[model samples]
Target: MAPPQPKAVAKPAAAPAGGVQKAKLGKPRNYDLGNGVVRFSKTKMFHKKAKYKFVGKKNPKAEKAKKPTVVVKQIGGEKNGGTRTVLLRRRRSFYPTQDKITPRPHHKTFSKHVRRIRPNLTPGTVCILLAGRHAGKRVVLVGVLPSGLLLVTGPFVFNSCPLRRVPQRYVIGTSTSVDLGDFQLPAHLDDGYFKKNKKSAKRTVKRKTGEDIFATKKEKYVPSEQRKADQKLVDEAVIKAIGKRADKKTLRGYLKAAFGLRSSQFPHRLRF
Candidate 1:
C-alpha cells in the first residue's frame, strides 16, 4: 500500500557529560552506606570508585589496642591508720627488688653440721700395712678413693703388694714419703687401667707377628702369659727406680720407724 511507508527509526540515547553513560538500572547507589558495608555490583559493566583512599588500611577489629594498667601507692603511714591519700600511676613495666623476690624452693642449702673426713694417706706416701695377708709390709700409697680407702702398691718388690685397696684405718702412715719427681701416677686412676694397658701391650706384640704371616686376615687374640710377663717387667722397673737394692727387711724397718710403731705391734714371724 502506497510503496510501504518506511518505519520511523529511533536514535540511541546520548551519553552523560563525563563520557560515561548512566547505567540502565540508574546511578550506582549503595544500599548500605554508614554501616561500613560494601556490596559489589551484579552487572558486568559496573565499576564503582571508592569514596576515601588509604595507603594501608588496617582492620580495627583484627587487632585490639592494649589498655594500660594502673598501680596504686599510699604515702604518709597508711598502714599505721593515718590519714593518707592514695595516688594512682600507670604501670608500664615491673621490676622486683631483691627483698620482694622469693627464693627458689629447691635452692641448695648449706649446713655447718655436715662433716667430711679426708683420708690421712696421700700419693707417694710410704705406709705399713696393719692388717690382711700383707700385714707389716711396706707399701707406697698410689691413689686415694672417694670412700676414704687407700690404694697401695709395692711394685711387686717390697712385699708383694699388687695394686690393692686397703682401708685407711688398717694402714699406718709413715714419715718416709717418696718424692714423685719424674714418676707420674694419677691420683684417681682405677685398678683396671693398669691391667688393661698391660694386656694390650702383650696383645699388640702378637698382632704384629700375625700380621706379617697373613696380611689380609684379622685375629683377636689375647695372650695371658705374655701379659703377666709384661706386667712383671713393668713392676720390676718401677721397683728398681724407687729403691735400688733395698732388701725387704730394710724397707720394713724404715716404714716401722716412720709409723712410730712399737716392738709389740710388730709381727711375730715373717710370712713371706
Candidate 2:
C-alpha cells in the first residue's frame, strides 16, 4: 500500500521426510492407510497401551471345603422280611439336640396342647359316607384292608351300595357297632374280586333254539349267590344296631338320624 511494495509471494508448506505432516502441539489428527489400517494419534496410542497393561493385582483368600457327616438308619419292613439300611449324608444338623448342646428338658407333650382325635372306624361300625357316589349314604363298616382302607357295604337292600373299598377319610364313623364275631371276612378280599364276579355275571346267555323268540328280552345279572345271602344277614345286623339310635318310622328318617343330618342338609336335597 505504501509505494507499491513488492507483492509478497505465499509459499506452500513442505511435507516432512517421511511424506507425512507433523501434527500440531495441542491438536492431533489420525492418518488412514488403505485396507482398514488407521495410524492413531500419540495420545490414543498411549491410552490403548495403558488399557491392556495389568497394573493393579489382587490376591483372594482360598475357601476351605467342608465335609458332610454320614448317618445310617434302618427302614422298611420287619427284621428279615423286607428291611434295608439307608445311608444319609447330613450337611447340617437337623435335630434340635444335635444343633445345640443343651440338657434334655422336659416339655409338655403335643397331646397336652392339641388333642388329635381320630375317628374310631373299627369293623361292624356304622359310618356315613362323606364323598363319592355313595356320599351321604349310611354304610356298615365290614373290615380294614392292609393298606388302611375301609371295606364297607350298603347291603343293596338299603342304600344300594355294593361291597367297596373306601378311604377312611371319606367316612364319618359313629358310636354304634354290631357284634363282628360272626361277620368275619376273608383277609385278602379286595375290589378286584367283586369286579371279577360282576364281569362274569354280565355274560350273555346263549339260547339253544335258533328262533329269535326273545330278541327284546334282557335279563339282569346276579353277581354272587352266597355273598348276597351274607349281605342280607349283615344288613339285618346293621338295622338292629342302628335301631337303638335311629327312628324306625321310615327309611329316610332312619338314615337321616343315623347320619345326624339336619333338615336343611338332607341327603335327598344336597347335590354332589
Candidate 3:
C-alpha cells in the first residue's frame, strides 16, 4: 500500500487579471503550426472553441453549428400567425418584366376625421347661413379656418355673402358677438384665400380656340378686381366694426332679416 502514495497532480488555474470581467480561457495556450508541423501544439488547432468544464454548456454539435441559413418560414405552417413573412432572399426574378410601383399606403393617411370647430364659432361671430349658396344668410364670423373652416362674411356690401368657406357644421351660432375693435383679419384671408380657379378661364379659352365648348356663354362667376379689392377691404372693416356698435340698429337688423322658423320657433328651444 506504500506504492500508491505518489499520486498528487492538481495544479493549474491562476490567469485572471485584466479589466472588465472576461478572463476565462485557462489552459492549453501554445501553438506553432508552420505547415501544421509536428512541433508542440496543444490546442488541436487553436482554442477549438476551448472549454474547461461548463464553459457555457450545451452542444448538439454546437446546436448544429449555430443555425440561421435564413429561416422565418411560417406562412402556411400557420401556428397562430397573422403576419410573420420573411421571404428572405430566394432571388431569380431579376427584372425581366414587372418592376412594380403604385401600391400606395406605407404612409400618408391623415385628416383622421378632423372637422371640429364650432364652440360658438368665434372671431366676431354672427353665423346663420346653414348649408351653402348662403342658406338663410346672416354671415359674419370673419375667420377661423386651419381646415376647420368658418371665415364667413355677408360683408359683400351688406348681404350678398361673398368671402366664403363655411362648414362649422354649416354655421348657426348667434348670441351675436361682434366687437372686432382693431379689426385684424386680412393677412390675405386664407384657406388659400377662397381658392377658385379650378382651371376655367372660359374652359381654358374654349380649349385653346377650337370653340363651341358646349356653345359657350355660361362662364359667369366674374368677381375679381382682386375680388373687388378684397370685398372693399372686408366691407370697410365691417362698416368699421358696425360703427362702434351700440347694437348698430340691431346689427343692421340681424343682417337684413329672413332666417324664418316662426310657428312659435323651437330650434332646440333657440337660445341663439
Give the TM-scores of the predictions, in the order they appear: 0.34, 0.37, 0.28
Number of the top-ranking candidate, with TM-score as the measure: 2
Report the number of the highest-lDDT candidate. Answer: 3
Better of 1 and 3 by TM-score: 1
Instruction: Please write out the lDDT profile of model 1 over residues 186-251, one tens digit for every residue.
Output: 443554544443232222333656455433434555646644564465455455555643464565
1-272, model 3: which lDDT tens digit per residue? 45666768988655567634555776543444567665455565345545555566876653346445465555555576554655456567755467667776665345444666757777888878867667998878877767777777777767777878877766678988777777777677777768877754443235666776565344667887887888788778876888788879888877877596888888888887
Better of 1 and 2 by lDDT: 2
Task: Show how many residue pairs clash in every candidate, following the order shown.
Answer: 0, 0, 0
Per-model RMSD to reference: 28.9, 24.5, 19.5
Candidate 3 weakest ten by summed lDDT: 199-208
lDDT of each: 0.58, 0.65, 0.72
**Model 3, runs deviating above 4 Å:** 1-26, 29-94, 102-105, 109-123, 126-139, 142-146, 155-159, 166-176, 179-215, 219-245, 250-272
Off by over 4 Å in 1: 1-120, 186-241, 244-272
- Clashes (candidate 1): 0
